[model samples]
Target: MKRFFTALALIPSAAFAHVGDHSHVAATHLLTEPDHLGVIGVVIVIALGAWLWRRGRS
Candidate 1:
């Protein structure tokens, strides 16, 4: 069970490299559109909050 959790945790880092291409392209599309920046800001805030919440729990 411990090893299973360990592998599961490592899988994200390995998998993340392939996932960002689409988002990167989308970000480029929004580069000239200031209106969408707010959405990006919200996502950043949520991500930071989740990261901090997990760290605090740990």
Candidate 2:
């Protein structure tokens, strides 16, 4: 579980690579870039699924 969260924590690093280039419009860049958008989308889906699974378990 610790390793899972560690991996998730680092997943956003890919999106940060362009931070300096789009400081003024990072939000826009994140929305427009397919790679970045996909990363965020996948993360959100995974997190939501995990939450639902854990809730069901309890």
Candidate 3:
């Protein structure tokens, strides 16, 4: 659907938006790394899928 595509399109921008010189012991690796970004993509997809699933149930 159009809404799904819209959310997909926004994923990359939203992923990078979290990067703003914030230091953390939790995530030692840099966010700009390809592997880190890929992990973020997977997490985003999972989160979006969960959200859509819950929304549809309600």
Candidate 4:
């Protein structure tokens, strides 16, 4: 049982092992582009609106 748990813990690390091995082109663009900034701003506005609405309900 102990060995099984240990192997299970390693599964996620092994699954992501190739994540750092390549350049992620989309991720780079998402962070640096002005066009994507509008999307980020919308997300922030929605999140804040949801939080305020919940606060008002409580």
Top TM-score model: 2
> How far is 13's C-alpha from truth in model 1 (Å)?
27
Residue-wise lDDT of candidate 1 within 27-46, one digit each (tens)?
56565544456555655675
In order of lDDT, best first, we have 2, 3, 4, 1
TM-score of each: 0.47, 0.64, 0.49, 0.49
| Candidate 2 residue pairs in backbone clash | none
Q: Which of candidates 2 and 4 is the stronger one according to TM-score? A: 2
C-alpha displacement of 51 in model 2, angstroms?
0.4
lDDT agreement with native, every candidate: 0.55, 0.76, 0.68, 0.58
lDDT of 3: 0.68
Rank candidates by TM-score, best first: 2, 4, 3, 1
lDDT of 4 by residue, 7-49 (tens): 6566453334333433546677656755456656755775687
State the displacement of the C-alpha of residue 12, model 4, in Å, after optimal TM-score superposition: 31
Of candidates 3 and 2, the better by lDDT: 2
* Predicted candidate 2 versus true structure: per-residue lDDT over 1-58, tens digit per residue: 5877888877765666454566567577778887788777888898899889889999
User: How large is the C-alpha RMSD of every model relative to the true structure?
Assistant: 8.3, 2.9, 8.4, 11.7
- What root-mean-square deviation over C-alphas does model 4 reach? 11.7
